[model samples]
Target: MNAAIHEFTAERLAGGDQSIGAYAGKVLLIVNTASNCGFTPQYEGLEALYQRYRERGLEVLGFPCNQFGSQEPGEADEIASFCQKNYGVSFPMFAKIEVNGDDTHPLYRYLKKAAPGLLGSESIKWNFTKFLVNRQGEVTARYASATSPEAIAGDIEKLL
Candidate 1:
């Protein structure tokens, strides 16, 4: 079997190492985010999903990325502050990481490989791209940047 997402580790925006394994057995909505993107407002919908389904095993993880248009050019503190103040985001947010190119974060590298995008492309096209993983750590689906969090609610419900 392929490696589970729980096998990866990333730094928390608040400044500490975090093992993805800590979220094992939880349904995950892993998203690449940016502060100034056109889709930035989706944070509200994401938070709504987290609030609505967290008790049912859903865990939304946000990873700030500046690889696209330099939209998330803030330091970890600024990024965390923006998310909380603007969208009241309480879901876990990770430190800035690349979602594409040479320095792509290892977690993202695994996600893209497991759920390649349109035309089987492994590279992420834009920020807010999401990967939904089931409790077993299997990547069940990949959602494009345009896919709203609300639209993924049913899928998450099924997993739960």
Candidate 2:
């Protein structure tokens, strides 16, 4: 899975720099999140998943995205505050990024390539689109926005 996800050095929403490489060898749920979208509440379930299985090597990585209907329009600080105060999302979260088109973030670009959408489409349909990466850094599944976190508990449990 080398080069599947381009290296990135981005600030965590919590207040520090983090390298994507630090998460290697872990099962990762990479989600493009939005604080105002219909699926925004998934943060609660996501945090639930993280708190439940973090010791078992499950990592939930959130990348706040506003490209979908301006659902998330907040500064980095505000976004971070929202996540912490509202959902208790202790999981890592990055600054807002565009997940599709020519200016797509490097990490999203790599993920989309690794797991193409239906009919081979690379574009992300909406917020909350999730990419589940296995221990070997390969994307194992792509869950749409409507697929709630609790719905995938069984799959994550097996991975753990």
TM-score of each: 0.97, 0.92
**Most accurate candidate by lDDT:** 1
Off by over 4 Å in 1: 1-3
Distance from true position, residue 13, model 1, in Å?
Answer: 0.2
- The whole-model lDDT of each prediction reads 0.94, 0.87
Backbone atom clashes (below 3 Å) for every candidate? 0, 0
CA lDDT of 88 in candidate 1? 100
Residue-by-residue lDDT tens digits, candidate 2, 91-141: 989988899988898888888988998899989999999988877777888
RMSD of 1: 1.3
lDDT of 1 by residue, 1-160 (tens): 2346888999999989999999988999999999999999999999999999999999999999998999999999899889999999999999999988999999999999999999999999999999999999999999999999999999999999
Candidate 2's displacement at residue 69, Å, is 0.5
Candidate 2: C-alpha lDDT: 0.87
